[model samples]
Target: MSSSPQPEAELAKLRFTLEAANAAMWDIDLVANTVVWSENAEQVLGLRPGALSTTFVAEPEWIHPEDRAGTLTALWEAARGGETYVIEHRIVTADGETRWVTARGGAVLDDDGSPARVVGVLVDITDRQLLAERLRGELAAKDRFLTTIGHELRTPLTAILGFSAELHDRLSDEELAPVRDIAQIITQQADQMVALIDDLLVAGRDADSPVPIDPHQVELCGTVRRVIDGWPDEHRGSVSIDEGPVRAFADPIRLRQIVRNLIDNAIRYGGPTITVRCWETPIEGRSHLVVIDDGPGIPSTPPEPDTGVHPTGIGLAVSRRLAERMGGSLSYEHVDGTTRFELELPLEA
Candidate 1:
């Protein structure tokens, strides 16, 4: 009959299994300050596989200086306090290459119930750590590039707005009626362009909320009419509004911004006609503004900007944020083949 497999053979089989997993096993003697390693452990520790004592005199030196104290403390806690630990840290190889390693270990108790030894496994995680660092570096570089581009765009934009405002003022003084209309158009378009740049910079910030809004009691009908009238002459006839002196607690600037963005989107993306409506839901007693268009519906787009991007949904996102900052909410619904957007605000008492 074949003899039962010896413990030594079983141990060798276990070590082979560990080697197959790309892991190295270690057994540390608490009393002798020495360690026994699986055959493959030396390569994992960045050491040449050679005959050496069970003691690892240079092992502490291999650990990163910043991590050495913490590593020793963790080992002591596991060996003395019967705790288990998993640590990821850097180790210097024989050739001075830094590698990240993850170690998981527990202590074995002696017959007297005192800590006798610690056994552990080590794995190289250098590739994973390196990949994480690379991604973070790439993200940081992208943010810096966006900030620089925003600043560059703002320089020429500031000059354009200033000159347009000056020309608009001068045209009012002269009786050049035809050129006055053109000057007014340039000033209006310039103002809208500045709002777009402001939206870009504000929305691109790395923060939970980017819009800074101050809420006040705003008369709604006049504001809404003025905004609708400001639209291009061609699209003005396409929009209809319900005339009422409805009041809302909202930031005036943000309110106009939100209105313009919504109107702009409807004209750009909607079907033939659009309607603006408002009413107060007195159940909980609140005022809400509604804008509906015969558009297909609001569609989700890729978050990243593409070249030659339009202002349709781009400004819509920041409009929602500005509404929220003023203690209001912006919501969208598509019903009966019409796309509807509503801005709900607290009623100013």
Candidate 2:
């Protein structure tokens, strides 16, 4: 076996390995206010690779103008306090093209404990930035499509519901039972369609520009009362509430959504029995708004196609997200002959 390699030989091997990985090395002389770069450094700086001295000629000219201030600040901090840092920024290439790179380095202190030099490596990351930008564009396009579809659907649905309501008013309940029933069905289904469209539009909204959640102490009983009262006549009587002065700290809009979604899901999927109850859980210092229905409980495995009931879909998932966003939690359990969904939230202090 060959003798152990010398320290100088090992350092040379490390430099070679870095260059092979497309990483350029940088060394800054703090006292001289000058920088020395490896041959590959020019490549990362957007300059022809042969020029070793091109880096310090004018550092800002090599960096993207928008990134120069932040980059210089990082470089200065490393030199001043011997701080190690990693920064990702764009560089302007000689061809006027912009490329992303990440630089990692720290100050090298002298014998007197002063910064003698700063050293680091730079690696290209343009591909990652391009992929992120592409994903954002695709998401924005999807949001616009949802908004356009909502506008298109609501226009015709409003007209159908209005005309059906007028006709229902004109005919006596005893005159044509079939025709009266048809008009009532049309109105109810159209209203449901409108609500579904609204929820779809809400889902596609820009998360960065979300309507701010405005949380405050709110009375759950009154909100439930209004929501139940607004349900279609046939479905309204099935829902019963025994909530009294139940209070929680929550965003009103989000609370309304969570309650409305639970109520609607119960009516559509819950077999025949449903109830809304609210009470304070003193042990947890929380308020529980519970919706109980006699539907088959959530399955151990998702339901198969054409089964008795499909699993809860996007609508309920969104409601769960909203509840969590407001410093609250939602849970589900199957009690004797009933499926219970409880929305647990903060009690007003």
Candidate 3:
């Protein structure tokens, strides 16, 4: 075997490794109140070589004012025989620019089992931190835009809905049948627009939180029937339901949204015929509604990497979220060349 490496060679190797990783080594002597830094410490910190401070106490001046106290406290604790610590804080450069850095350190003990020095490595993370901040800003801006547009659209939509309803109620006589039909159509379309805007408003809010809902006793079959009836005449002919008397404690509006979205997905992506079935499982004391279609199943693989595009569209996602918020769950499966979406809910006693 080759001779063991000399101390100088080992130090050179360590310096080379640190340089490759864009990090600098630092050591603070507790008893002497002094600090030492590797040759590249100033360079890593965006300062000219030999310009870095050597005094242990003066190091906090380089740290951002908001983070100086916490950083100093953590280092002091580590030097006082505390456990190893890792901290990410902002550092201020000589030119008043702020940069993020991650520091990791531990105490080095003397023979008496007391910390004699605190040693650590510092790595620059300014680029990564800035990128994360920019992304967050973009998301906030997008949410604000969506919320504003949704509210603006809703104002006109509400007026349309109110006028259409008033006109429908006023023209109930048989002689003005054609006008009443047009008014009814306008009312239905405006109501659909309201639901769409509501979805947009919800999307503009924080997604991690569950969708808000108000739940009450609901005649489940009637809700499902209303969603089916709302479909256009042409597509409505292709849909059928096995309507059983089922009661559920749920948000009727959101329940209708879920049902309508499922049916719409089926009509768009599924086969020509669609079937909906609702029933209560006595043993489980829960109610379930299943929408089945004979169309091709969801694609086995996504079309593009990292693109979370659902095969059917965003409606399924919204419907599933609403179902879960109302103490129910929506799930999908493909069996025997048939695609089935099932919604399970708590049964109203």
Candidate 4:
């Protein structure tokens, strides 16, 4: 049978593990004003082995200038029976290079309930800090590119739509039927481009910025009908509107956008059958507008992480955001072989 290892052997193994993890254990004596470090301290702190002087007073010099005062205050507070000391800050190594580290420790009290010492660990986190900074920079660049492209495309689309409308009005005579058909097609395609540009602009803005809303009393049935009628003829097939009309206190423009996006999503991914319904709930004077389809619903699991594009599409995500910004909510449910997306809004502002 193998014998159990001695205490000294276990200590050596623990020191080896800490060194491999880019960490060092430390102990500080309050009364003696002295510090003791594991043998690997020099490696973690970017100094030659045996070059460090173990004194509590010398620690502040190692901390970055901006973090020195806060670090000292936290240590003093921990000694006075306060919370454990935990901080992530910059440190200046002996090689004159700045690095990020997280230090965590707690005070050890004596029999009289006074702090006699503190023990802690220092972990090098320079790689993690650098990675986070790079991600932020990439996100900012994406937002700027989206905003610029959205504005540029919108300018030409607006001109194309205006010209198409003018041609349609001037060529209304039966003799010019072929020319009028071409103009109508141009207007329809231009309208779709405008909607896409709106989504891009929304994606470019800061998420916390409030969406601009102008609310008023609006009839839900008419708004929903208008959006459906605007769809291209082929995409409008197999859609039926249920016969109850409801009113809501909401932004008409945003309501139209939400409705259009939902219908487009259903047409792209759902089964042939589709229905739109509107009704007032019995309690709270709230109303619901739902889009239903007979198709296999979205997967139970969430979309994959870090993919940028939503699984269903960006339209549904934008619709959900707009609904909440207008004091409403959008939810989804898959039940009894049918998928439903419901939007609820107040009857009064």
Q: Please name the candidate that would achieve the greatest TM-score relative to the true structure.
A: 2
lDDT of 3 by residue, 1-349 (tens): 8999999999999999989988989998888988899988887887766666677765467788999889988987877855688999998776778899999999999999999989999999988999989988887787778768988998999899889889988997899999998998998788778776766555445554345688888877678678777555777889887855787889888898888778878887799999888888868878898899999867665543443436445567677777777778999999898999999998863
Clashes (backbone N, CA, C under 3 Å), per candidate, total: 0, 0, 0, 0
Lowest lDDT sum, 10 consecutive residues, model 2, at 303-312
Best by lDDT: 4
Note the Cα lDDT for every prediction shown: 0.78, 0.79, 0.81, 0.83
Model 4 worst lDDT window (10 residues): 202-211
Model 1 superposed RMSD (Cα): 7.9
In angstroms, the error of model 3 at 17 is 5.0
The ten-residue window of minimal lDDT in model 1 covers 304-313
lDDT of 1 by residue, 145-217 (tens): 7678877887887787678667766776556766867866776677677678767765664443244567888
Candidate 3 regions exceeding 4 Å error are 1-21, 29-34, 46-55, 76-83, 107-117, 175-179, 200-307, 321-349
Spell out the clash pairs found in candidate 4.
Answer: none
What lDDT does model 2 reach? 0.79
Clashes of 2: 0
Root-mean-square deviation of every model: 7.9, 4.7, 6.0, 5.6
lDDT of 2 by residue, 1-349 (tens): 8899999898799778867777788887877867777666776566866645633554567788999889988988887997898999998888999999899999999999998999998998898899888878887777777778989999999999899888877778586878987897898789878777766666555565343478888888777888767567667888888856888888887788788888888887686777889988767878889999998766566644653233555567666667777778888888787989999888864
lDDT against true structure, model 4:
0.83
How do these models rank on lDDT, best leading? 4, 3, 2, 1
